[model samples]
Target: MGNVRLRQLVIAAGSLDVADTLADVLGLGEAFLDPGVAEFGLVNRVYGIGDQFLEVVVPTALTAPAGRFLARGGDGGYMAIFQTDDLAGARARADALKFRRVWNIDLPDISASHLHPADVGAAIVSIDEARPAASWRWGGPDWERRAAPGKLTGAVITSAAPEQMAARWGEALGIPAKGGVIRLADATLDFGMGKEERMVKFQVSLPDVGAACIRAARRGLDVVNDEVRIGGVGIVLSG
Candidate 1:
């Protein structure tokens, strides 16, 4: 582990339009699509929220990874990405733990390794290493300048064996499991016990949760108790 931080969360959606709806409810804008990403048989949109990024990937081919994941779990949270200083070292550790690298991207400024979710017994996790660490190429230039109202604070994952899954991810990321949460440099992964394993929610730090709920309502999104469901994942607004 070397200066690891939660960088981005990937949502596999039925279409980019669905992703746009969710982004509207969250007040995230300036969506950027990379044709290079589409060449990989997938279409993607990245929204800037503070220094962090939120991406939605939709498969254009039946054999695409996103499509397969959508088939297994439907439209929902699909991957959690961590920015690390040592991608090679991280891959070595993951290999030792019997984690498989299903996909990768290697470039002059950016590199990544995607671990198989089935082997990790959780959601797909990607170890990313970027040149300046603050700048993400996938999100395009001046991502930080994009209009956004809140910061991503945390993500929620549910598993039947919460403790076991937490411990496993903890060991893999070299992060200590404290209670049900795995603390990262930028955010926390809150593990909750559930009947099945899945990414269930995300926490955003906004000025007013109630006002955010009202905003979502105005966008025609259903809100309850200051939380709304977007593609099987709960968007929880908090101060």
Candidate 2:
């Protein structure tokens, strides 16, 4: 595949209230609501979390793909998108690795291709390419604005063998690693411990760890001391 950039991280929640609550707890900015984009399905809302975007997906009466995911994973982390320069080249790489493409969409100024989770040993992986204009759609006015003092700290990914998982991501993204961390232009991915033979974790960062934790607890969320468990994933808001 051509050069690719790690894009956004997605979390699928069962209810809008839950998603909004979690966003609020994380101090995530306003949400950019999307009425409908997929036929027989709809994306309820989208939020801006710094350079990355968070999509709060709820299935419509017609039962969209998001619904199927909710049925399987319950409610938690869903997918990760890696922005690429060439969609076809990325698909070829995935195909060469025997990864199945679950869906492919070609849109104006943007194209997306997804690979099955079984191949990645995690959730679905998507490669996206778009013109500059498309980026703003995700970071536009409807989303929240936070003046953070630091960049995206990093993401936590739960895996059976942290090293192995890190290697897999390194290979997939064609990026080298350092000290068990895959450094990207915009973020970092850190593999953490797993549970029940399945990886369970979430990406988190904060301007101030202590303050963010206090805010989370005050929101009535089940914050166990400093760490909060969301959909079986251990989350720690770090500065």
Candidate 3:
């Protein structure tokens, strides 16, 4: 999308232990622990990837939504958030497509709406607009500091009907897919065919994938070729 940017990505795990390993593997420096998420029976930490963010949430209770996702054999790539300049326009498009908002927040600094996963047909999707275009309240203060500046470049979502799912997301975002890839301002979403719908992989643009793979190996992470597994998702390094 011309005006939309890939702002944040989220992962769900069974425990917060993934935080340390992921940080070590990705060279993510400081993390912000948000207490507000406990209200949803979960605990989370947000790591800044430059101005963008990578967050991981683990369920504190068995009945939590993330817990249910894990119970269904899901543990990675929970949500993909995009920052748009016109949230109202996005919501109107979503409404026209019959996509329901499962949760939302409105504040002076930020406004966001999470779409229903069932309707999205893959991973959870959130459309948000941050005031001033660059500020993100969810990533917490001083998130601008980081050890490395790995950018979120793309995400790979698998669905039984990949083309149709991509069409739905593309239409909702006002950026139609080229083939099966929905291109954004800073990232692209690639939809692939799978037995079931889920977010399977994430792509990041880094200075050196070789160095990242070495670090991942030292952390005892599962590194295969140019991809590393953390929090039950494949993090592929490119560029």
Worst 10-residue lDDT window, candidate 2 = 142-151
What digit string (tens of lDDT, one per residue) describes model 3 on residues 1-239? 33998888899998888887777778788899988889878899899887788899999987998888889876888889999999999988888889998888999999988898888877778999999888888888777764358899989998888999999888778899888889898889999999878888889877777888899988877777789988878999886
Which portions of model 2 miss their true places by more than 4 Å? 1-4, 40-42, 61-64, 133-152, 161-165, 176-181, 192-199, 222-226
| lDDT, residue 201, model 1 | 91
Error of 3 at 17 (Å): 1.3
Q: Model-by-model lDDT, in order?
A: 0.82, 0.63, 0.86
lDDT of 1 by residue, 141-165 (tens): 7777884767788898889888788
Q: What does candidate 2's lDDT look like per residue over 34-70, in tens digits?
A: 5544553755556566666655566664367667767
Mark the 10 consecutive residues where model 3 has the least summed lDDT: 141-150
What does the lDDT read for residue 149 in candidate 2? 32
Clashing pairs in 2: 29-144, 30-144
Separately for all candidates shown, the number of backbone clashes (residues 3 or more apart, or on different chains) is: 0, 2, 1
TM-score of each: 0.93, 0.77, 0.95
2 versus 3: better TM-score goes to: 3
> Would you give me the overall lDDT of model 2?
0.63
Better of 1 and 3 by TM-score: 3
